[model samples]
Target: MLIKYLGHAAFLIRNVEGIRIITDPYSPTQGIHYKPIDENADIVTVSHEHWDHNAVDLVGGNPVVIRKEGERSVRGITITGIPTFHDKEGGKERGENTVFVFDIDGLRLCHLGDLGHKLNKEQISLIGRVDICLIPVGGYFTIDVKEAKEVIESLNPKVVIPMHFKTSSLDFPIAGVEDFLKGTERVKRLGSSEYEIEKDKSPLEREVIVLKPAKSS
Candidate 1:
Protein backbone atom coordinates (compact mmCIF):
# COMPACT_ATOMS: atom_id res chain seq x y z
CA MET A 1 0.00 0.00 0.00
CA LEU A 2 1.07 3.60 -0.59
CA ILE A 3 0.39 6.42 1.87
CA LYS A 4 0.53 10.00 0.70
CA TYR A 5 0.18 12.85 3.17
CA LEU A 6 -1.59 15.66 1.39
CA GLY A 7 -1.02 18.26 4.12
CA HIS A 8 -2.86 18.56 7.44
CA ALA A 9 -4.86 15.42 8.30
CA ALA A 10 -5.72 14.58 4.72
CA PHE A 11 -4.10 11.48 3.23
CA LEU A 12 -4.47 9.49 0.05
CA ILE A 13 -4.05 5.77 0.58
CA ARG A 14 -3.88 3.47 -2.42
CA ASN A 15 -4.01 -0.28 -2.36
CA VAL A 16 -2.11 -2.65 -4.62
CA GLU A 17 -5.16 -2.94 -6.89
CA GLY A 18 -5.20 0.82 -7.47
CA ILE A 19 -8.20 1.37 -5.24
CA ARG A 20 -7.90 4.75 -3.46
CA ILE A 21 -9.15 5.59 0.01
CA ILE A 22 -8.83 9.15 1.30
CA THR A 23 -9.06 10.30 4.88
CA ASP A 24 -10.17 13.72 6.13
CA PRO A 25 -10.24 15.68 2.90
CA TYR A 26 -9.74 19.36 3.85
CA SER A 27 -11.26 22.44 2.27
CA PRO A 28 -9.26 25.35 0.89
CA THR A 29 -10.44 27.64 3.72
CA GLN A 30 -8.81 25.54 6.41
CA GLY A 31 -5.94 28.06 6.71
CA ILE A 32 -3.74 26.00 4.35
CA HIS A 33 -2.80 26.95 0.81
CA TYR A 34 -2.40 24.17 -1.73
CA LYS A 35 -3.81 22.90 -4.97
CA PRO A 36 -7.24 21.41 -4.44
CA ILE A 37 -7.51 17.60 -4.21
CA ASP A 38 -8.69 16.50 -7.65
CA GLU A 39 -8.06 12.79 -7.38
CA ASN A 40 -10.89 10.29 -7.31
CA ALA A 41 -11.37 7.90 -4.43
CA ASP A 42 -13.29 4.70 -3.93
CA ILE A 43 -13.88 5.45 -0.26
CA VAL A 44 -13.64 8.44 2.07
CA THR A 45 -13.70 8.47 5.87
CA VAL A 46 -14.81 11.52 7.79
CA SER A 47 -13.81 11.60 11.45
CA HIS A 48 -16.30 14.30 12.38
CA GLU A 49 -18.62 16.82 10.80
CA HIS A 50 -16.07 19.61 11.10
CA TRP A 51 -15.13 21.69 8.11
CA ASP A 52 -11.49 20.71 7.95
CA HIS A 53 -12.01 16.96 8.14
CA ASN A 54 -15.37 16.48 6.41
CA ALA A 55 -14.93 18.28 3.14
CA VAL A 56 -16.49 15.44 1.15
CA ASP A 57 -17.56 17.65 -1.72
CA LEU A 58 -13.96 18.44 -2.51
CA VAL A 59 -13.23 14.84 -3.41
CA GLY A 60 -13.91 13.53 -6.90
CA GLY A 61 -16.04 10.50 -7.81
CA ASN A 62 -19.10 9.37 -5.87
CA PRO A 63 -17.16 7.70 -3.13
CA VAL A 64 -18.74 5.78 -0.29
CA VAL A 65 -18.56 7.82 2.92
CA ILE A 66 -18.02 6.30 6.34
CA ARG A 67 -18.38 8.56 9.40
CA LYS A 68 -20.08 6.72 12.24
CA GLU A 69 -18.66 4.11 14.55
CA GLY A 70 -19.07 0.53 13.33
CA GLU A 71 -17.66 -2.01 10.93
CA ARG A 72 -17.75 -1.45 7.21
CA SER A 73 -16.41 -3.25 4.19
CA VAL A 74 -15.96 -1.59 0.85
CA ARG A 75 -14.20 -2.81 -2.27
CA GLY A 76 -12.67 -5.74 -0.33
CA ILE A 77 -11.31 -3.50 2.41
CA THR A 78 -12.54 -3.92 5.98
CA ILE A 79 -12.76 -0.86 8.25
CA THR A 80 -13.76 -0.47 11.87
CA GLY A 81 -14.50 2.90 13.40
CA ILE A 82 -13.92 3.24 17.12
CA PRO A 83 -15.68 5.98 18.98
CA THR A 84 -13.44 8.76 20.33
CA PHE A 85 -13.54 12.43 21.18
CA HIS A 86 -12.23 15.57 19.53
CA ASP A 87 -11.39 17.10 22.92
CA LYS A 88 -10.43 15.88 26.38
CA GLU A 89 -13.77 17.07 27.69
CA GLY A 90 -15.49 14.03 26.15
CA GLY A 91 -16.87 15.86 23.14
CA LYS A 92 -18.39 18.67 25.24
CA GLU A 93 -15.63 21.05 24.20
CA ARG A 94 -15.05 20.04 20.60
CA GLY A 95 -17.15 17.02 19.54
CA GLU A 96 -16.98 13.30 18.83
CA ASN A 97 -14.19 11.76 16.79
CA THR A 98 -13.89 8.42 15.05
CA VAL A 99 -10.69 6.44 14.90
CA PHE A 100 -10.68 4.26 11.80
CA VAL A 101 -8.91 0.92 11.72
CA PHE A 102 -8.57 -1.00 8.51
CA ASP A 103 -6.38 -3.19 6.37
CA ILE A 104 -4.87 -2.28 3.03
CA ASP A 105 -2.59 -4.55 1.04
CA GLY A 106 -2.21 -6.90 4.02
CA LEU A 107 -1.14 -4.08 6.34
CA ARG A 108 -3.27 -3.08 9.31
CA LEU A 109 -3.55 0.71 9.61
CA CYS A 110 -5.15 3.07 12.08
CA HIS A 111 -6.05 6.69 11.51
CA LEU A 112 -6.78 8.79 14.61
CA GLY A 113 -8.79 11.75 13.42
CA ASP A 114 -8.24 14.92 15.40
CA LEU A 115 -7.98 12.96 18.61
CA GLY A 116 -7.64 15.15 21.69
CA HIS A 117 -7.26 12.79 24.63
CA LYS A 118 -5.23 9.89 25.87
CA LEU A 119 -6.60 6.46 25.10
CA ASN A 120 -8.36 4.71 27.90
CA LYS A 121 -8.04 0.94 28.30
CA GLU A 122 -11.33 0.37 26.51
CA GLN A 123 -10.40 2.57 23.57
CA ILE A 124 -7.06 0.83 23.19
CA SER A 125 -8.66 -2.58 23.33
CA LEU A 126 -11.12 -1.67 20.62
CA ILE A 127 -8.31 -0.48 18.36
CA GLY A 128 -6.37 -3.71 18.93
CA ARG A 129 -3.01 -4.07 17.15
CA VAL A 130 -2.00 -1.60 14.48
CA ASP A 131 0.88 -1.72 12.01
CA ILE A 132 0.81 1.96 11.12
CA CYS A 133 -0.74 4.71 13.22
CA LEU A 134 -1.75 8.06 11.75
CA ILE A 135 -1.87 10.28 14.82
CA PRO A 136 -2.50 13.92 15.60
CA VAL A 137 0.19 15.49 17.78
CA GLY A 138 -0.86 19.12 17.70
CA GLY A 139 -2.55 20.67 20.72
CA TYR A 140 -5.59 23.00 21.13
CA PHE A 141 -7.91 21.03 18.85
CA THR A 142 -6.17 17.70 19.34
CA ILE A 143 -3.84 15.85 21.62
CA ASP A 144 -0.55 17.58 22.38
CA VAL A 145 2.85 16.00 22.02
CA LYS A 146 2.90 14.55 25.53
CA GLU A 147 -0.52 12.98 25.20
CA ALA A 148 0.32 11.69 21.73
CA LYS A 149 3.42 9.96 23.05
CA GLU A 150 1.33 8.33 25.75
CA VAL A 151 -1.14 7.05 23.20
CA ILE A 152 1.67 5.70 21.06
CA GLU A 153 3.02 3.82 24.03
CA SER A 154 -0.33 2.18 24.60
CA LEU A 155 -1.04 1.37 20.95
CA ASN A 156 2.51 0.28 20.18
CA PRO A 157 2.12 0.53 16.44
CA LYS A 158 5.09 -0.41 14.29
CA VAL A 159 5.15 2.90 12.44
CA VAL A 160 3.92 6.25 13.78
CA ILE A 161 2.97 9.13 11.48
CA PRO A 162 2.21 12.44 13.20
CA MET A 163 -0.30 14.84 11.71
CA HIS A 164 -2.46 17.95 12.37
CA PHE A 165 0.48 20.08 13.45
CA LYS A 166 1.58 23.53 12.36
CA THR A 167 3.21 23.88 8.94
CA SER A 168 4.11 26.77 6.66
CA SER A 169 0.62 26.58 5.16
CA LEU A 170 -1.34 25.90 8.33
CA ASP A 171 -2.33 28.79 10.63
CA PHE A 172 -3.74 26.71 13.45
CA PRO A 173 -2.55 27.52 16.97
CA ILE A 174 -0.59 24.32 17.42
CA ALA A 175 3.03 23.39 17.82
CA GLY A 176 5.10 22.15 14.91
CA VAL A 177 6.09 18.50 14.34
CA GLU A 178 9.49 19.27 15.87
CA ASP A 179 7.86 19.47 19.28
CA PHE A 180 6.79 15.82 18.98
CA LEU A 181 10.09 14.51 17.56
CA LYS A 182 12.30 15.84 20.39
CA GLY A 183 14.54 13.13 21.86
CA THR A 184 12.82 10.44 19.85
CA GLU A 185 14.96 7.53 18.72
CA ARG A 186 14.68 5.57 15.46
CA VAL A 187 13.12 8.43 13.54
CA LYS A 188 13.14 8.49 9.74
CA ARG A 189 12.29 11.59 7.80
CA LEU A 190 11.27 10.60 4.25
CA GLY A 191 11.62 14.10 2.75
CA SER A 192 8.77 13.24 0.42
CA SER A 193 5.14 13.01 1.46
CA GLU A 194 4.62 9.50 0.09
CA TYR A 195 5.74 6.21 1.66
CA GLU A 196 5.15 2.65 0.57
CA ILE A 197 4.83 -0.17 3.08
CA GLU A 198 4.44 -3.90 2.85
CA LYS A 199 3.40 -6.46 5.43
CA ASP A 200 6.53 -8.58 5.09
CA LYS A 201 8.79 -5.57 5.65
CA SER A 202 7.06 -4.35 8.83
CA PRO A 203 9.46 -2.96 11.39
CA LEU A 204 10.39 -5.12 14.35
CA GLU A 205 10.14 -2.18 16.75
CA ARG A 206 8.29 1.09 17.01
CA GLU A 207 9.56 3.85 14.72
CA VAL A 208 8.37 7.37 13.94
CA ILE A 209 8.18 8.25 10.24
CA VAL A 210 7.88 11.87 9.21
CA LEU A 211 6.59 12.62 5.70
CA LYS A 212 6.63 15.93 3.87
CA PRO A 213 3.48 17.24 2.20
CA ALA A 214 2.96 15.95 -1.31
CA LYS A 215 2.94 18.56 -4.05
CA SER A 216 -0.68 19.55 -4.50
CA SER A 217 -2.40 19.19 -7.91
Candidate 2:
Protein backbone atom coordinates (compact mmCIF):
# COMPACT_ATOMS: atom_id res chain seq x y z
CA MET A 1 0.00 0.00 0.00
CA LEU A 2 1.15 3.57 -0.75
CA ILE A 3 0.23 6.50 1.47
CA LYS A 4 0.18 9.96 -0.05
CA TYR A 5 -0.53 13.05 2.07
CA LEU A 6 -2.29 15.61 -0.10
CA GLY A 7 -1.90 18.79 1.93
CA HIS A 8 -4.19 19.61 4.80
CA ALA A 9 -5.98 16.34 5.79
CA ALA A 10 -6.30 14.97 2.27
CA PHE A 11 -4.66 11.61 1.55
CA LEU A 12 -4.49 9.15 -1.34
CA ILE A 13 -3.87 5.49 -0.57
CA ARG A 14 -3.22 3.01 -3.37
CA ASN A 15 -3.20 -0.70 -2.84
CA VAL A 16 -1.08 -3.22 -4.67
CA GLU A 17 -4.05 -3.96 -6.94
CA GLY A 18 -3.89 -0.34 -8.17
CA ILE A 19 -7.15 0.57 -6.42
CA ARG A 20 -6.96 4.04 -4.83
CA ILE A 21 -8.73 5.34 -1.73
CA ILE A 22 -8.75 9.05 -1.02
CA THR A 23 -9.33 10.63 2.39
CA ASP A 24 -10.50 14.20 2.99
CA PRO A 25 -9.81 15.55 -0.49
CA TYR A 26 -9.30 19.29 0.08
CA SER A 27 -7.59 21.63 -2.36
CA PRO A 28 -7.77 25.40 -2.02
CA THR A 29 -7.68 26.12 -5.76
CA GLN A 30 -7.92 22.86 -7.68
CA GLY A 31 -11.16 21.03 -7.16
CA ILE A 32 -14.21 20.67 -9.40
CA HIS A 33 -15.34 24.27 -8.74
CA TYR A 34 -12.80 25.79 -6.36
CA LYS A 35 -10.00 23.39 -7.22
CA PRO A 36 -9.84 21.99 -10.75
CA ILE A 37 -8.25 18.60 -10.04
CA ASP A 38 -10.48 15.53 -10.20
CA GLU A 39 -10.29 13.70 -6.86
CA ASN A 40 -11.82 10.57 -8.37
CA ALA A 41 -10.88 7.38 -6.62
CA ASP A 42 -12.20 3.89 -5.94
CA ILE A 43 -13.33 4.94 -2.47
CA VAL A 44 -13.48 8.21 -0.54
CA THR A 45 -13.41 8.32 3.27
CA VAL A 46 -14.46 11.48 5.06
CA SER A 47 -13.78 11.95 8.76
CA HIS A 48 -16.18 14.80 9.45
CA GLU A 49 -18.56 17.32 7.94
CA HIS A 50 -16.07 20.20 7.97
CA TRP A 51 -15.62 22.06 4.67
CA ASP A 52 -12.02 21.02 4.47
CA HIS A 53 -12.61 17.40 5.37
CA ASN A 54 -15.93 16.67 3.65
CA ALA A 55 -15.34 18.09 0.19
CA VAL A 56 -16.09 14.67 -1.24
CA ASP A 57 -18.23 16.08 -4.04
CA LEU A 58 -15.26 18.07 -5.26
CA VAL A 59 -13.48 14.81 -6.08
CA GLY A 60 -15.70 14.55 -9.20
CA GLY A 61 -16.46 10.85 -8.79
CA ASN A 62 -19.48 9.07 -7.37
CA PRO A 63 -17.23 7.41 -4.82
CA VAL A 64 -18.85 5.74 -1.81
CA VAL A 65 -18.55 8.20 1.11
CA ILE A 66 -18.35 6.94 4.68
CA ARG A 67 -19.47 9.26 7.51
CA LYS A 68 -22.06 9.71 10.23
CA GLU A 69 -22.13 7.13 13.09
CA GLY A 70 -21.53 3.52 12.08
CA GLU A 71 -19.12 0.91 10.82
CA ARG A 72 -19.24 0.51 7.03
CA SER A 73 -17.02 -1.41 4.69
CA VAL A 74 -16.06 0.15 1.40
CA ARG A 75 -14.09 -1.42 -1.36
CA GLY A 76 -11.80 -3.65 0.77
CA ILE A 77 -11.44 -1.25 3.66
CA THR A 78 -13.09 -1.83 7.03
CA ILE A 79 -14.11 1.69 8.09
CA THR A 80 -15.24 2.33 11.64
CA GLY A 81 -16.62 5.77 12.44
CA ILE A 82 -16.03 6.68 16.05
CA PRO A 83 -18.13 9.66 17.20
CA THR A 84 -16.14 12.47 18.79
CA PHE A 85 -16.76 16.05 19.86
CA HIS A 86 -15.12 18.84 17.96
CA ASP A 87 -14.09 20.64 21.13
CA LYS A 88 -12.77 19.80 24.57
CA GLU A 89 -16.06 19.36 26.41
CA GLY A 90 -19.05 17.85 24.64
CA GLY A 91 -18.66 20.15 21.60
CA LYS A 92 -19.88 23.35 23.24
CA GLU A 93 -18.75 25.29 20.19
CA ARG A 94 -17.91 23.94 16.72
CA GLY A 95 -20.11 20.84 16.82
CA GLU A 96 -19.09 17.17 16.47
CA ASN A 97 -16.36 15.40 14.55
CA THR A 98 -16.00 11.83 13.23
CA VAL A 99 -12.78 9.94 13.70
CA PHE A 100 -12.17 7.25 11.05
CA VAL A 101 -10.35 4.02 11.83
CA PHE A 102 -9.74 2.00 8.70
CA ASP A 103 -8.27 -1.47 8.52
CA ILE A 104 -6.66 -2.41 5.22
CA ASP A 105 -3.96 -4.82 4.16
CA GLY A 106 -3.80 -6.07 7.74
CA LEU A 107 -2.92 -2.57 8.93
CA ARG A 108 -5.03 -0.22 11.00
CA LEU A 109 -5.00 3.51 10.19
CA CYS A 110 -6.66 6.45 11.89
CA HIS A 111 -7.38 9.91 10.56
CA LEU A 112 -8.40 12.57 13.06
CA GLY A 113 -9.97 15.16 10.82
CA ASP A 114 -10.01 18.68 12.19
CA LEU A 115 -9.85 17.31 15.71
CA GLY A 116 -10.34 20.35 17.94
CA HIS A 117 -9.20 19.18 21.39
CA LYS A 118 -7.22 16.57 23.23
CA LEU A 119 -8.94 13.21 23.64
CA ASN A 120 -9.75 11.55 26.95
CA LYS A 121 -9.44 7.96 28.18
CA GLU A 122 -12.78 6.88 26.76
CA GLN A 123 -11.98 8.29 23.34
CA ILE A 124 -8.58 6.63 23.41
CA SER A 125 -10.13 3.24 24.15
CA LEU A 126 -12.40 3.47 21.12
CA ILE A 127 -9.58 3.98 18.66
CA GLY A 128 -7.52 1.05 19.99
CA ARG A 129 -4.16 0.53 18.22
CA VAL A 130 -3.30 2.62 15.19
CA ASP A 131 -0.58 1.86 12.69
CA ILE A 132 -0.61 5.37 11.24
CA CYS A 133 -2.15 8.61 12.46
CA LEU A 134 -2.97 11.52 10.16
CA ILE A 135 -3.11 14.28 12.77
CA PRO A 136 -3.69 18.03 12.89
CA VAL A 137 -1.34 20.65 14.32
CA GLY A 138 -2.81 23.86 12.99
CA GLY A 139 -4.14 25.01 16.49
CA TYR A 140 -6.95 27.53 15.73
CA PHE A 141 -9.46 24.84 14.79
CA THR A 142 -7.48 21.81 15.84
CA ILE A 143 -4.79 20.49 18.13
CA ASP A 144 -1.52 22.41 18.40
CA VAL A 145 2.00 21.06 18.62
CA LYS A 146 1.87 20.48 22.37
CA GLU A 147 -1.52 18.80 22.28
CA ALA A 148 -0.40 16.66 19.37
CA LYS A 149 2.47 15.42 21.49
CA GLU A 150 -0.04 14.10 24.00
CA VAL A 151 -2.12 12.46 21.29
CA ILE A 152 0.96 10.71 20.00
CA GLU A 153 1.72 9.40 23.44
CA SER A 154 -1.76 8.01 23.91
CA LEU A 155 -2.12 6.44 20.48
CA ASN A 156 1.46 5.28 19.98
CA PRO A 157 1.10 4.99 16.22
CA LYS A 158 3.89 3.57 14.14
CA VAL A 159 3.74 6.57 11.78
CA VAL A 160 2.47 10.10 12.42
CA ILE A 161 1.74 12.67 9.67
CA PRO A 162 0.92 16.24 10.65
CA MET A 163 -1.70 18.20 8.73
CA HIS A 164 -4.08 21.25 8.65
CA PHE A 165 -1.85 24.30 8.51
CA LYS A 166 -1.00 27.42 6.46
CA THR A 167 -0.21 26.74 2.83
CA SER A 168 0.25 28.81 -0.33
CA SER A 169 -3.54 28.70 -0.82
CA LEU A 170 -5.22 28.15 2.57
CA ASP A 171 -5.85 31.73 3.79
CA PHE A 172 -6.67 30.81 7.37
CA PRO A 173 -4.21 32.20 9.91
CA ILE A 174 -3.22 28.82 11.32
CA ALA A 175 0.21 27.93 12.60
CA GLY A 176 2.84 27.07 10.02
CA VAL A 177 4.73 23.80 9.55
CA GLU A 178 7.67 24.98 11.60
CA ASP A 179 5.54 25.03 14.72
CA PHE A 180 4.92 21.29 14.30
CA LEU A 181 8.54 20.56 13.53
CA LYS A 182 9.99 22.68 16.29
CA GLY A 183 11.97 20.62 18.80
CA THR A 184 10.95 17.44 16.98
CA GLU A 185 13.99 15.18 16.89
CA ARG A 186 13.39 13.99 13.31
CA VAL A 187 11.25 15.74 10.72
CA LYS A 188 11.97 14.49 7.25
CA ARG A 189 10.24 15.81 4.14
CA LEU A 190 9.11 13.06 1.82
CA GLY A 191 9.71 14.51 -1.69
CA SER A 192 6.40 13.33 -3.13
CA SER A 193 2.86 12.86 -1.91
CA GLU A 194 3.34 9.07 -1.44
CA TYR A 195 5.08 6.80 1.07
CA GLU A 196 4.80 3.41 2.77
CA ILE A 197 4.44 2.99 6.54
CA GLU A 198 5.66 -0.30 7.96
CA LYS A 199 5.09 -1.53 11.51
CA ASP A 200 8.08 -3.83 11.71
CA LYS A 201 10.46 -0.89 11.50
CA SER A 202 11.32 1.47 14.32
CA PRO A 203 9.84 4.99 14.50
CA LEU A 204 12.29 7.90 14.49
CA GLU A 205 11.70 8.26 18.25
CA ARG A 206 9.59 11.44 18.51
CA GLU A 207 10.03 12.29 14.85
CA VAL A 208 7.36 13.59 12.48
CA ILE A 209 7.28 12.91 8.74
CA VAL A 210 6.37 15.95 6.65
CA LEU A 211 5.09 15.15 3.19
CA LYS A 212 4.96 17.63 0.34
CA PRO A 213 1.57 18.41 -1.17
CA ALA A 214 0.52 16.38 -4.18
CA LYS A 215 1.00 18.06 -7.55
CA SER A 216 -2.09 20.06 -8.40
CA SER A 217 -3.62 19.22 -11.72
Which candidate should be chosen as best, given lDDT against the real structure?
1
Report the C-alpha lDDT of model 2 over 1-217, residue by residue, as the tens digit.
6887776778888766666788877645432122433657888877667676777877755778777757877777778878887777677888888888878777788888878888889889988888888898888878888998889889998778887777665667788878888877667787776788554554646456787766333
RMSD of every prediction = 1.2, 2.8
Write model 1 residue lDDT over 1-217, tens digit each, in one string: 9999997899999999998999998886857665677879999999999988898999998999999999989999999999999998999989999999988888889999999899999999999999999999878899999999999999989999998988877778899999999989999999899999999998898889999977343
In order of listing, the candidates' clash counts read 0, 5
Model 2 misses residue 83 by how many Å? 1.0
What C-alpha lDDT does candidate 1 achieve relative to the native structure?
0.91
- Cα deviation of 38 in candidate 2 (Å)? 1.6
Worst 10 residues of 1 by lDDT: 28-37
lDDT on C-alpha atoms for all candidate structures: 0.91, 0.76
How high is the lDDT of residue 170 in model 2? 66
Cand. 2 TM to true fold: 0.88
Any residue pairs clashing in model 2, and if so which? 29-35, 30-35, 30-36, 31-35, 31-36
